[model samples]
Every structure is written in structure tokens, then in C-alpha cells.
Target chain A: MVEYKDGADFLSPDPIETQVLQGSQDSEGVELMVKKNNDRLTGWVSYTLSRSMVLINGLYEEQKVNGGVPYPSNFDRPHSFNLVANYRISRRLSFSSNIVYSTGRPVTLPVAAYYAEGRPFLLYSARNAYRIPDYFRIDLSVNLEGNLKFKKVAHSFWMLNVYNLTGRSNAYSVFYEVEDGAINGYQLSVFARPIITLSWNFKFGNYNSN
Target chain B: MNIQHTYKYTVTKLFPGGVRPKMHLWVVLIIALAVNSCIEPYFADIGDEPELISIEGSIIKGLSRQEIVISRTTSLGNPVFEPVKGCLVSVMDELNNEFVFDETYNGIYTLEIDQSSLVEGRNYKMVVVTPGGAHYESEYEILESSVPVDSVYYDIEPSLDPVNGIEADGLQFYVDLLAPDTVSRYFRWKITETYEYTSAGPIHYYYMDLSFEPVVPDDIWGLYRCWKTDELEDIFLTSTLNLATNEKKQIPLNYVSTLNDRLKIRYSLLVHQYALDEEAYNYFMQNKIATEGSGGLYTRQPQQPITNIYNVDDASERVLGYFWTSEMTSRRIFVSKLPELDVKDYFYPLEIFNMEDHGAGPFPMAIMEEDGVRITGSPICFDCTRRGGTTERPDFWE
Candidate 1:
């Protein structure tokens, strides 16, 4: 069965306030998911094997100005994938893990540079001028809960493992600072922050059956 | 039973040859479709941008002129405005009569036309010569307007409102309709006044008229504020009517009695009917009045000008007519002359033309403070008049 579904914020302009479109035909791929059976062994897979682009107002050989085009704001990427799964090992314990992979984001890099108004505003090259490297990450977590004896008490434990598998760096922006004369790329990245946490809680409740 | 040998040979060829040919054809078709397709799912890499073309022009018809600005589109198919310079933007009639646009300042240009040049049925077009040698043009028709004002007059009586103190209430000009009537008509007015500075020796004369009406009273009064630093000029006294009305109105020129005192007031009104967008009309009006008081007179010439509407007027221009009024200090009786002459400017010389006589006072005038310039007795003399114009200086007396 094919069905059209509107997300909770389908009509909103900026759902995440990120000032970026979630998907577009000439820019990036969007994905949907299916759930089978129960929460157990439930996993999602999404891949953006496509691209999106912005045809800027004045970013062409015939439209260069000191103050670049009207923000062509490029959002392009291909081959994005996300997989997550949860498995119940016993009546009291469950484990979950998730994996994400996506192609690099597009960015504009200036070629030749000039000073204007004594500030650094870019005269961007064409549109999606450059691409950052790909990104990948995996995370896992486990939870345990049980009822205790004639006292009518329950206990729960949660353990989370962030960046459980591979360690990687995701690039966000790259620019050059003119000191002396040499032009070099100054890379900025979101490094993997590997972490783990454990929490325990006790509760008292009536285990009533009807 | 005898056909066994023949069947074996046929089966062999059918199994391999027929299936293989079909499979090969399908593979080749799929490959061609993919190769010819220009629709890539991936975005193409864009390159650097190049310089854009700039187009500059203006709208000029009758007493109205507005700057026309637009830019060219990019490869991304979007329009972008440019920092334009050195262009001959002008308007020409079919008679080959043209006004070369002077780049008075930035993208702004000017072309003045008198009422005569604006015929009821003549056509006008604006042409622009770009810095890069490109020409662009747009045309419009001239629209003539009927007289907006039936009449203007002053209140025969003084103000009774004591809040304003003893003073002249003012003159009011009433139109035939409510202001900004559905049918828009542009109008203007001017006022001329002469005041004696000191001992009736030097008469400081002032003259101003609205380029179009209803006039912005604040802008007009602002000029007075600049000239006389001590007191705030009362702008509310001057008003404009956008529509038509039969009611008579007044324009008050409150008198200021000083050690160097003499006063006279005069004003005129002009109106035109023209089709204009709200912004364009507002801009034209604002620039006209604001530019006038600040500095720079718009005159006829191709040289440097303050605004584009200079020299646009001509003789025999049938516009809303002008009005004039005058006041002389000589014709008045005072309180001291009550028995013998009782003439107005004679005794309490200041009270003759004041609004209180007409019952318009607690003058509706603003409260001003003393600058330690003491007033001992009958002659309320201050070292410095609060309105900033002072009698202390010899030059002020003249």
C-alpha cells in the first residue's frame, strides 16, 4: 500500500531552526522507514544517494559583484544511511545499537581574494563549490529492570556507550587567514567524543494483575 | 524414432543461441538510456561569478520625478542590483527635446519641468545610457489635475484658550474634500514674512512656499527652528488638505514682540494632479521639502543639482494658484492710547494682532524657561530670547 504522510512539522519553514532544508531534488536524498513485529529487533535504514543544489542569484561568470550572490545556500550530499536495532536478550535486559553514514556536505570556497570595507565577507565561487569528507558513527546502549521479592520493590539500570565503534572527524567549515602571504586551508571539524555512562534507579509500585 | 539425431542438433542451438541474443539486447538498451541522460541526481559544481550589467533610469512627468533602479539576472537566473556610476539618464519628448540626467549624487538624477511643459496630453519617456554604452528606455503619459483648493483664510478672532496664552491662533486652508481623497492631487504652498529685528531698523524678511500640498508643517517649521535657535518652531499651524472641501481655513503667523520687533507673514499654495504610487509620491514629497530647507536650490541646467525636479516648471503653468498675506506693526492701538487714540499698536503694541483679542488664548503656546536673562519690569527683556534669536548682539539688532 502506498500512502502520503505529513510529518509533524511538514509545513513548517525551519523545523529544527537550523536554517537548512531537510531535502530537495537537486540537493539531498530523504528517507522513510517501516516497522515490523515489535520493538525487539526494530531497526531503521536510510540512505541519501542523491544530491541537492541552489541556483544562486549572482554566482556566475556574468554576475560577479564585490558582495557575492544572494546566498545560494548550498545543501548537497549523496549516499546517506542510518541503521538502528534493538534486541531483548531476556525478560529483564535489552540492548540497542545504531549506525549512521552520510556523504560529505557541500561548501563554498573563495578562489582569488580581495579586501572590501575592511571586513572579511566572501565573494564565493560558484554554487556547491566544495565537499567535506564523509561521516560515520555507531552507538550502543543496554537497560535492565526487575521486581524484587515480598517487599514490593523494583530496580532498573541503564548503560550507554557513545561512539561504540569507529572514531572519526566530520568537517564543517574551511577558510584561510591571510598572515604574510601564504594561503592555507584552516580546517574545522566535529571530533568524536567517545563516552559511556551508567545509571541505576529503584521504584516502589503495586504489581496488580487484572 | 528416426528423428532422434536431428532433434539433438536443434535442441543444442535453441538452448544457447536464442536466450543469449535476447539477454545481450536488453543490456545494451539499458546502457544507452543511462549514457544519454543529463539529469544527474548529483548537483553540479558551480564556478565563480562575473560582473553584472547595471540599468539606471527615472520617472519624470510634470512636477513628479522618481529614481528607477534595476539589475541584471545571474546564471542562476536571479536579478542583482549593481553599484552603478557615470550614466546619462534622461527623459525626452517626441520633439527631440531632452534633459541630460546629472548624477547629482549616487544613483539619484534630476529633471525639472514647469506646469507649461506638462501638457494635458503629451507623452514622456525616460532613456538611460549606461556606463558600458547600453541604452534602456520606458515611457509614460502626462496627467493634468484640477484646482484642489476653493479658498484659504485666517480666523478673524484671537484664541480664547488661555493654555496657549495671549497669541494669534493662526490661518487654516480648507479643501473641497478629505485629505488623500481616492483621487490624488499634488499641491504646494508658500509663506512670506518680514519681522523687524531691533528698533524698527532691520526688517528680517522670510519667504517659503510648498512645492506641492498638503504641506508637511513640521518640515516647514523646521527651517524656522534652524534660523532662530532659541524657540521651537510651531509646525502644527501649517496644514495640507488632500481632498476637496468648501470650508474656509486659516494660516496663523503668531507675532513675536521684541526689542528688535516688527512682524509680517505671507504664504501661497500650489496643487497638481498626477498618478503616483504611494512610495514614489512620498519620496518625491519628502525629498522636495527636506531638500529645500536643508540646502541646494533645484534650477534648470544640466550641471550639478540638488534634486531632479529643478527647472521642470514653465511659464503659463496652470497650477493651483498662490496666496499672499501681510502684517505691518504700524497699524495697531494699545491700552495706553485707549482715551486719546486707543489705537491697537499704540499702547500695548504687542496685544493688537494677538490671538486673545480674537479669544484664542491661554495661548496654546509652549512653556519656555528663563536663561537667567532677567525681566525686571514692564519691558519683559531677556539678555537672550528663548527662541535663540537674541537682542544682546549688535548684529541681532540689525
Candidate 2:
């Protein structure tokens, strides 16, 4: 199925703190998925290819972003692949795993520098012309169920989850800042390390009978 | 028990903490998720942008010297423009006649052609040979006859400038054109304005000798008054195809603020009209839209306007600019002061000054006066030549 969406946002740069920029985003994409359910190994794989662009022409020509060209939207990732699998090891234990891969998000980068009015300024490439590194992550989790008993008032299951099993530092964003009359680029990753979580899911009133 | 009551009780029992309190946590999580969205800088490898040749010129009938400019586009970061020099340029008609152009300035070429040789309704084209041995030519353009302007006049009207907002007193200039009898015509106009202005102060008396004793009155040589002329840069195009009548009335050319110095004294405007073919008209119309449509919420996609000129050797090589032949008609009008229009009180008051020959040198000092007293300031103020215009009158000046 084909889909179309429109969105708007308010952006403010540091120099013009009071100046709020109004930008519009347009996105169109298609998705496809294949699933094998009710089998020994239940799994589903999906892929999506899409393009999104943002036009921030601003109220005046001077405030135009990306020289008024429609740049790639922040969420625009042309290609994405996702695989989710769940396999039952036994009646009491089950395993689930997920793998995700997608093209990196768009970012505006500086291509060159110049001096104007005795101050150094960076000339940026077209808005969103470059992207962060491609993103890939894998997650795994195991579910352990308690033994069934007719007299028990409640039964519980424990889940052990490992987020970002490989601890890959997928870049959340790449940023540039002017320092010492020069522009410097840096990458920032929100989830830079693996995380583990343990949780108990409970059912009341002899729910195991079903 | 009622189903609604049962559901409500179950929800309350499921969350010992009231639903409202638990919902607050969910709201916070959502807000955090939204705030966590980030923006970063990235380097895009767009590769090398091709530098293409840019040619700008026109072939007008009856012109002694036709001028053309050739330059190359630069990369995004560099603001400097590179002009193409030492190129062979020529204009040729279908009758095998050729007019060659000589490079006068950087990237600028000029040709002196016989005005009698330019015939109306004859097809003409421009050819250029680059220093790198590339040949370029434009499509043949027929010189169309132009209609004379019926009148050029100005009216005081209230108007709004998109950039500066409502201007209550504006002098709007308009052109009236007589309709062609049979064929539909496209019209393009160019406006040139010349205005007289004076410097701050007119030097009335000066010391003829270096000695402090001799002061002589200077003769009135019209040194205070000068004139400056400039051509308008905006593109203006109108066509009679959509109008019911062949005659177009009061087509607006430009507007001047009542407070503007151009209207303070005497102003003259020269309006040139050209008749264009359908293709040339379309090209100019698109050019007008592209330039005038900027600084607004709606903007046309940034693309080069298709030019008639193309590379003769390599069809893939992109060329910029248009070459077309058109018959042109011109009209001039002079405007004096209008007492009927109400304008804001604005004036540059002159200051009186005294000069002394101190043994070291001669120095001028400002002489203060009462608030209502009017006195001329220094020569820099009243001298017209300081403003970059000559005291000599133009041949066509009325």
C-alpha cells in the first residue's frame, strides 16, 4: 500500500533565539512484509523503501533553509529491513529475537568555509544531503514461565531482555560546531551500550487453565 | 453487574494506583520520546558541480553596437564569478550576412552592425566559439514589429510593498500601448530613470589666495546640481493574448515613494518596449516568475530557465542565456514636483561654517545657529559632482 503524509515543525537556531522557523515535510513510501505464523518457528520479515523531503522556505527569503531547496526529511530512510522471530524452546521457556537495519537519517553538513565581514562562516551543503552511518541493531529476550498448579491464585512469567545485544554505537545524530575559528564535526549516539532488563508479567485468577 | 461497571472495576483493580496517575507516567514517556528526537550535521558527497558557460545578450534592430556577456557558474561556496574571455562571438542572419563582436571588457563583447542591414521579419541567430574549441549557437529568432507606447504617465496612489508594508503616498508609473490590428503581441518593458540632486552645501565664498586677506565670491556655475541615471533591474512582461482588446491600458511599470529623493525635484524616465515571439515571451514570463516569486511561502522549483542557445558540438553541454531578435519602441517622460500629493516632511538642512587661515593651514569650523535658522553647510553637501553626475544636460533632456 502506498502512503502519503505531511508534517510541520518549529525550528530555532542559537543566533536567532527568538526567530522560529516553520518548515513542512512531505513523505511517501511503500512497505512489504512476509510472515510464517503457527509454525515451530514463528517469524516475520518486513522491508520498506521511502523518500521524505522538507521545505523550510521561511517567511522571508533570507531565512530560507537549505537555500529554499526541498531537503531530505529527518525521518527519511530510503531502505529499512526488520526481522522478528519467536521460537518456543519448551512449554516453560521461549526465545525471541529481533534484527533491524535501515539507511541512516539525513543531516546538513558543512562543505567549505569562508570569511564575511571579518567573521568566519561555514558554507553548508544542501540540507540533508549527507546521512549518518547506516543503522543496524539486534535484540534478544527469553521468557520463563512458572509451573502450573490448580490451587494457585496467580501465575507469573519472567522475561529477560538484552537490548542492543552487540552494543553497537549507532549514531543518533552528527553535529557541527564552530570552535577556534574552525568547524568541527562530531557524532552522538543515544544508545551507545547494551542494556539488560528483567520483568515479571503476572496473570490473576487461575489464568493458566486456558 | 453492568458491563461498564465490571470493566471499570477491573481497570481500577489492575492498577492499584488510580488510572489518572498511571496515565501521567505514560504522558511523560511520550514527551521524552519526542524530545529525544535529534538533529545532526552530516557531510554529503554531491561530487563536483559542473561549471557551465553563461551567455546573456539580445539582438535588437537598429542598434549600432550589440553587447553580450559570457561567464561561467561557480561552486556553491565561492561568491566570485569567473568571466569567459577571448571567445569569438558573431551574429548571423539567414541571408549569409555576419556581424562579428570584439571583446571589449572581461567577458563583455560588442559588435558594430549596420542598422540598415537589420530587416524586420528576418531570422537571425548568434554563434560563439569558446577558447577551448567548443561551438555554440542559438535558435533562429524572427524580428517582430513592436507597437509604439500610447502614453507613459504617473499617478499618486496608495500601495503596499511586500517587504515594507503599506505606503500611503506612492507615485506609480504606467504605460499604455496601442493594440496590434491582427496578430497577438507580447510586450516587454525596460525603464531607465534620471534624477537631479544637490550636495549638502553650495560654496558661496572662498579665499582666492593662500594669504588670509583676500576672500572672493565664487561665480554661479551650477556646481550644486547634478543628475544620476540608472536602469531598473526587474523584469516586466505583458501579453495581449488573454486581453479582450489589442490595446493594453495603464500597465504598471514601477512605483516610487513620495518621500523618495527621486521625486523631490525633477525626474525623467525612459521606457523601452519590445515585441517578442511566443517562445521568447514564454521565456521572459518564466524568468519574471522565478525572480519575483521569491521571498514568499510559495516558491518555484529552482531550475535554470531553458535557453535557446545550445552547444553545437556536444548536445549534453549545458548553456545559459537566450538570444532573440525584436523590434523596439521607446518613450521618455519628465516629472516635476506634484503639489497635490501629501508627503511626509523630510529635508536635509545645511549647516553654516566659518573658515580661518591659521598660520599652519586653513580650517573650516561649524557655526551654530538657532533651531529655525537655515544655512548652507560645506561644499561636499551642495556640490552635485560629489554625487557622481555631470552638470552637463543630456541631449534629450527637456
Candidate 3:
């Protein structure tokens, strides 16, 4: 189905309130997936390719963002891959894992510099001309059940999970800042380290409720 | 086996304390994860921007020493302006008559054209042959007949200082164009403002022969009164196309705050009005929108100003600036400080020292005293040359 949306906020660093640009985005993509659900190794692999762009013709001459040219949307990522798997080790023990990879998102960056009125001013590249590093992460978890009988009055289980198992530092965004009369670029990562968690679950039901 | 009985037994044992505390912790963790967004510095190399030739000039009827400025755009990061020197520049009309320009200053070429040569409706264009053998030319521009300015006047208005949010008294200068019969014309204005000011204090006596004693000069010269002239920088344009009549009334040309020293004594403004063609008007209108417009949410996209001049060999090569010819008229007006205005509060008296207080007995010092203290002013007050203008009155001054 085709849909129409408007009033998307395009934020710029020049000024907060007045620099907010209005634009619409159009995104199109194709997704493919394969699954094996009935085997010992039950998993699904999915991949998607997409492109999204925005055109913001500013109301005033100064408000025009990126010279009124169409720019890649901030959330645009052309490629994404996901792999999820579950393996049954025993009647009481099972393991699950997930792997995800995606192309980096677009970002605006400064590419040149010039001096005006005795001050250094940066000339920026086209909006969203550069992208952050590609993103990749893996997660694994183990589940253990106290009992697996057909009929039981109550059941208990435990889960041990590890997120970002490889501890990859994927940049969430890239920004340019002026310090000491010079412009510098920096990368920021949201989840830069691995995380582990342990949890317990309990269930109570008769044979008919199973 | 009853399902209700089994669920009721497990529920009673599952929560020994309560689920509230655990749920609170989970909520905190989720919030922490949600706010973990970050930003960092990014650098990208976009290569160098091409340098282009810049030409700026205009031909006006009844004006002498017509000049053109030639310069080259420097690389990004360079603040110094690079002038295009040693170039052959000339202006030609449709009749094949030419006015050759001589490089009077670096990147500035001047030509003295006979007033008779500049006809009201003649078409003219400028040509420049650079040192690097690149040929450039401007499209032929027709000289449009100009309407004389009816008058130039000023009005007192309240204006806000952009830097400080203070409402202050200001002078708004305006120009009125004589009404035409039926033809609508585009108008461009250039202003030259001259004002008189004095230094903080005038020095009448000087320490003579290192004796610590002061000597009064034999005669007081042009040291106290100074005059300064400045050309307005901003673009000013108006059109009578949409007006009911072919007349534009009281269009604002510039503004000067009452706090400005230019209003201390006397100020004179000379406004030159030029008749512009439609294309020239559009070019300047676009330029006005680009340079004067502020950037933000409501800003118009910035684009390189389109120019009429182009490279003869390579059409795609970029050239900067504009060339046009027009007939012009001007009017001058003088403004004096209005009486009954509280001038004492805004004008600070210049500091003067007394030689008698230094125990120099019976020394002659120029004295202008308040509260019975003999005052001697600084050299800047006594020397008009330090103010960057001449003491000779302008020939056109009334």
C-alpha cells in the first residue's frame, strides 16, 4: 500500500527553533527471508535493501537546508541482515542466538573551511553525504527448565542471556563541533560494551492448560 | 486435575515479597537504555572548491572615472583577498566604440569616458582578458532613462539594537522618486554620507623646550573641526511595477542610531538613483535575498549568485559578479540635531587638564572650562587630520 506522510522534523545545528525544517520522505525496500522451523536447528535468516530520502524546500533563503537538494534520510540504511536460531540441547535445556548487521546511517559533516571577517567558518558537505560505520552485533541466551513432564502442577525455568557478545563499538551518530576556533569530528556509540543478565520465570497449569 | 487449583497454588508461592520492586528496576534499566544516544565529531574531505574570476562595475551617465574591480576567489581557509592584476579591461558599445581602462590600483581599473558617449538607450558590455589568457565578457546591458529624485529626507523613528535589546531613537533616511508618466522602472540607490565630528578635546598648548611649561600657539588652525565620508555597503532596491502610479514615495535607504556620533553636529547624505533593467533587477534581488537572508528553519536555500558574465571559451567555467549600465540622478540633504532633545545625557564632555595645577607658573594654555577648572585637551581634538578627512569643505556642501 502507498502512504503519504508530512511534517517530519529536520533538525539543524545552526539554531534550534528556527532551524527546524519540514520535509517528507519516501522509502522503498525489498525484504527476503528463509526459515527452517521443524529441524533440530530451527532458525530464520532475513535481509532487506532499502533507500530513503527527503526534500525540504525551506520557506526562507536562510532556512533552506542543503541547498534545497534531496538528502538521504537520517534513518536510511540500504542493507540489513538478521539471523535468529534456536537449538534444543536436551528436554530441559535449550540455546538461542541472534546476529544482526546493517549499513550505517547518513550524517552531515564539515568538509572545508574558509575565513570571513577574521573568523574561521566551516563549509559543510551536502546533508547526509557521509555515513557512520556499519553496525553488527550478536546475542546469545540459554534457557533451563526445572521439569518437562507432560503433566505437572507447577513449572519453573531460568534464563541466562548475553547481549552484544562480541562487544562491538558501533557508532550511533557522528557530529562536528567547533572548539578553539577549529572544527572537529567525533563518534558516539550507544551500547559499546557487552551486557549479561539472569532471570527466572515460573508457570502453573494443569495438563489441559499446557 | 483442576487447572484453577494448580494456578492458585503456584501464584501464592511465586511472589514471596512482591513484583513491584523488580518491576521498578526493570523500568529503570529500560529508561537508561533509551537515553543512551550519543554524538561524536565527524570529518570528511570534500576536495577543493574551484576559484573563479570576479568582476564588479557599473556605468552611469554623466559620471567620470568609471572603474571596475577584478579579483579571484581564494581557496576556502584563506582570508586574504587576491586581486587579479595586469589584465586588459575595456567597455564597448553596440556602435563598436570602446573606452579603454587603465589599472590605476591593484585589481582596480579606471577610465574617463566622455559624457556624450553614454547615451540614454545605448547598449554596452565589458570585456576582460586575464593574464592567464582567459577571455571573459558580459552580456550587453541597455542603459535605461532614470527619474530624478524628488527629495531626500529623514524621519525620527524608534529602532531596536540587534545586539542589545534596547529601544533607541534613530534616523531613517528615505528617497522619493518623481512619478513617471506610464512606464514602470526599477530603481537602485547608492548613498554617500558625510558627517562632522571633533576629537575628545583640543590641545591648544604644548610643553616647550622640555621646561614643563606650556606655550600657547600663535594661531589656531583646522585641528578642531573634522569631516568623514562613508559609502553605504548594503544593497538598496525598489520598483514601481506594481504600484498604482509610476512613483515610489519615501523608500528607506538607511538608518543611523541617535547614539551614533554622526548625528552629533551635522550630517549630510547624497543618494544616487539608478534606473535598472529587469534582468539586472532580478540579479540584484537574488543577491539581496542570498546575502541578507538569515539561515535557520525558515531560511531560503543558499545558492551561488548567477552572473551575466561568462568565459568566452569555456561556458561551464564559473565567473563571479555582475556588469550593467544605467542612467542615474542624485539628491543631497543635510540633517542637524533637533533642538529640545536632551543632548547632555548622550554627549560626554572631553577631558581637559590644567597646567596651573602642575605648578607651571603663568603658562598660557588654551582654556575651555567648566566649574572654573582650566582645561587643556588632547592632540586628537586639536588635529582634524587624525580623523581621516579634510578640513576643506566639500564643493557641493550647502
Candidate 4:
């Protein structure tokens, strides 16, 4: 055994190591749907479960992706559910609502900062190393029909639609920025708030729809 | 019966008279604005990130002291440079001349070697032993003399600012290389800028120990003239490996919008040029891509950079940075009162509100404008060193 009062001396730097990645993608999924149809209402509820994974060693063996291991794809969402229902308070009055939920999409982001010249640069994580926040939203609409008269020149209905009832800020994508030597992250949302729209519809002899 | 939206029958009477409703112009404007996208700050959850070792060093042939820096990388949100201290560092050249570097600061090691001691065409390598006895070494890097900079010059032109999409008149600087066709084509340049500025102005009034109203003073606080020198932090890379000739003209370096104080009165640029090898050049080229940080739709995925330094025992050790040898050259130029362009000081806030706002606080020092109008801001905003700078005038300043 060798011992030193302070520390042992080591020599020679090891050679540069390279990783090899070679594989294929695999995915599996299942979906179920339940429907309710009747004179008063018609709607459906659906749920889905899925997984997507990939492995590849030879993009010219660049190791540019997930280090050759199986990782979820960019669009992977393991679980999702959607529900739609309509209720009729009267022959001419009906209200419809929709609910949806889904696991977030896979994403790659900066894990740390690389500093040079007294400034910080971004260091990214492995591809698809994380996921965005989960997504959930709800919407509703009310339909009011005018008097039913085939002899009348035309029929009309008034509709009030409220999109994104809960005003959920679902992420469309994630991005980053570097300012004053500090790095910050932000998420972009296509529809960040609820939208309400009111419209009047009329059906002529050639076309009647609301 | 719920009314169903349907197409008209071949010959049936629907809403005999179609319904027409008036739409408000404001509602259309609101809808048009709503379709635009929105953004919010986000913090990602990246499982467990590895804390890495970062070693950056360079052997400058003409400089008296060569410095090497060692530090650790931290999370992006909280990137605090953790210096690695108490290390044994030394360099050995091909001729067996070994020089030990002293710890000038926590993680910075420096060695005072005469300019003549650096011999061109000789291979130099570095070895570092951490306090804990972990050994690390950089591959043998060959030193090559650098090509001299013929001149450093500036041109006044309007730039299409990529960030703000504004075309404003600004000063664009460039450097010329007169290297013969036989030398290496890979090179890097770093520019340091020094400028003189006066405070925005002084407050004509101040509150006294016991005064019902503000009192005007015979002498006000005015940083009449102070100088600030800053090393422009962007990487300027030039490669002509593909071109048949080594000589190039008008290699663009730095650009400053006249809207800032860099060229307000008298400004100087100290340009340092370095000759690099293929590996070092490639490393910097890739790092340039990573640091530019377009963060747009076309942003290419980033990969961990390959460091020239490595662990002696394990090749898999996570090490960062490049250690290389270069014969460097530098040139300095001063400019003042150019007639072709106009200069304007960029404006900023001295108060912290929301977002990326780091301000003096809810209340800032208020100064009276030249016309007696009042403006509130931090001391920096009113002094030559406002924003970030040194108050002492540089001896090199004319």
C-alpha cells in the first residue's frame, strides 16, 4: 500500500470517451368511448392511455439525442380524457358543455448555466428530459331556438358561447431568454384566457343551420 | 324540439327573411387582439442535474502574467460561480521548462513568465491537482504566433437591430488582418471599451434639517467627468479556413447604438486578437451558437460542449472549458466628435416595478431637470457611473 502525508500524485489524462446510440421507437396506446343518445340529449365521453419511446445510436452516432436510451417522444401524452354533454330545459332551450384533460407534452430545457467571460450561458438537458405542465380546460354554450314554423319565411336561433370556461393557461410551448447575465424561462400560450361570443343564426329554404 | 343547423331542402321555405345584426367596430378590434399569443415565466423541473467542473485558461505569449480560472457550474435559475480553490497548478512545455502558478485569488492562478520565455512551435500542457487530490490535465496544445492587427477602425451606419427591429444610426467597429497566406485561418478577438461621461445633471434643490420648503444650494452634486471601461462580453469569431487567402478586410467586431453612452464624448477601444487551433476554434464556434440564444422557433437543440481538460482517471468525468496556447496581439484607438453620426444615451428605469425590474426601490433619488422639472432615479442614473461603471477616469483616456 502507498501512502502520502498530503495527497497521492496521478498522471496522464484519459482518452476522450464516446457513446454509441442505436435503436428504434416503440409506442402503445388504448382508447375508450361511451356515448349517450336520446330525444333530450346526445353526447359522448372518451379516454385514452398511451406511451411513446425511442432509442437510436446511429444518427451517424452523433449522440445528439437521448444518449441512445429509450425516451418519450416530443408529442407524447400518456393520459387524456374528453367529455361533452347537452341538457334540454325546454323544447327550444338547450345548454352544452365540454371538459378535457391531458398529460403535458415532452420538452427539453436548460438545466444549468455555463459561465464564460463573467457571463452565464445556458446548458441544456437531454432531449425530452421533462414535460410541460398538464393541460385542462372547460367550455360551455347555450342555444335558444325561435318559434318552429315551416310556413314562416325562415327559422332563427340565438347562441351564446363561452370558450375556456375556467380560463386555463395551457402551454403551447416553452422558451428561454438571457438578460443582464441571468437566464429566465417562459411559456407561451396561444389562448391564455376565456372568450365569449354571441351570434344570431338564420336558416333559409336552401340552407338552415345554427 | 331543438333546432338543428341544416342545409335548405331542395324546395322548402326557411327563415324567409334572413336575420342581419349590426356588429360593433370595437368588438372586431378586441377579437383581433385576442388572437395574439401570450407568454408567462416558467420554471422547469429537470430531475437531478450534475454539478460540473469548469476550467478555463490560456497562455498568452506576449503578456507577463498568464492566468487560469477554475469554477463550478450551477443551476440556470441560480447560477452562482462557485470557485474551486487551493489547487496545485503547473505548466510544462516541450523543452522541459516547468513553471508553477501561484494562487492569486480563490480560484484564479497566475504565473509571471517573461514574454521571451514563451517559445513558438513548442507544445504546452497544463496539469491541476485539486485540494482533494483529484488529478486533471489538458492535452498538449501547440503554441503558434498570432498575426498582428493592421488597424482598428469604426464606421457609422444604420443597423437593423434584430431584437427591437429598429434601424438606428450607430457606430460599427472592425479589425483588419494582414497575415500572409501561409498562416492559420482560425482566430478569435475580444474588445475592451472605455468611455467618458457626465452625470445626467444635478438636483437644484435638497431638503434641509428644518425647512418648510426645499432649499437651493450654491454648489450641487455633479460628477462632471468620470470614465468607465467595460470588456465587451460578446464572442467575436472569424474563420477563413475555406478561403484560399489568409488576409481579410473589414472583419466586423462590435456595434453600439448611438442611443447609449459608449460614444457620448470620447471613446476608446482596446482590441486583442488571438490565433487558435482547429479544436479550440470549433469549440468556440459551437459555444457561440449556444450563447447567442436565439430561443426562436428555429433554435437548434444544444449539446454539452466537449472540454479540452479531462480527468486523469476517468474519461466520463464532467469537465467544462478549453485550455489552449495562443500568441496574442492588441491595438487601441480613441475616437471623439465624429460628424457623420449622432449619439444618444439609452434610457433606463431606476425604480423596480414588476418583471425583469431590479430597481433602486419603491423610492429613488429625485433630481431636478435643467428646466427645474423633477425626475426620480438612483444615484447611478444621475452619475457618470450610472447603470454600471467606474467613477475614476482611466489614465489612458485623453
The lDDT per prediction is: 0.37, 0.70, 0.71, 0.74
Off by over 4 Å in 2: A1-43, A48-80, A85-210, B1-44, B161-166, B182-184, B203-223, B296-298, B344-392
On the 0 to 100 scale, the lDDT of residue B238 in model 3 is 90
Question: Could you give the DockQ of candidate 3?
Answer: 0.17
- TM, every model: 0.33, 0.65, 0.69, 0.62
lDDT of candidate 1 at residue B221, scale 0 to 100:
21
Measured over the true interface residues after superposition, the C-alpha RMSD of each candidate is: 20.8, 9.3, 7.0, 12.3
- Tens digits of lDDT, candidate 1, A1-210: 111111112233554433122221334456666554575576666555665543322443222211233322334556778888888887567788888887767654443322211111123343444665567778877877554344464544455555535544444454444344433345554443444556665555522211
Tens-place lDDT digits, model 1, residues B68-136: 442332332222233356777766765776766666565555555454555444556666566676555
Model 3 score (lDDT): 0.71
Q: Report the lDDT of model 4 for residue B128.
A: 89
Q: Model 1 — interface RMS deviation?
A: 20.8
Task: Give the docking tier of candidate 2.
Answer: incorrect
Q: What is the DockQ of each candidate?
A: 0.01, 0.07, 0.17, 0.20
Report, in order, each candidate's fnat. Answer: 0.00, 0.02, 0.23, 0.50
List model 3 lDDT by residue over B1-398, tens digit each. Answer: 59877655565466445554456557767667644555544445445654667788778895877988887655433434567899999999999999889999988889988899999888999999999999999999887888778888888888887777877787888888776754337888889999877655445555543365556666455466778898876679998887777787789989988656778788899888888887788667766654455543124433344478999999978677789888878888988777633222224334456434544533333444446665554344456666587777788766
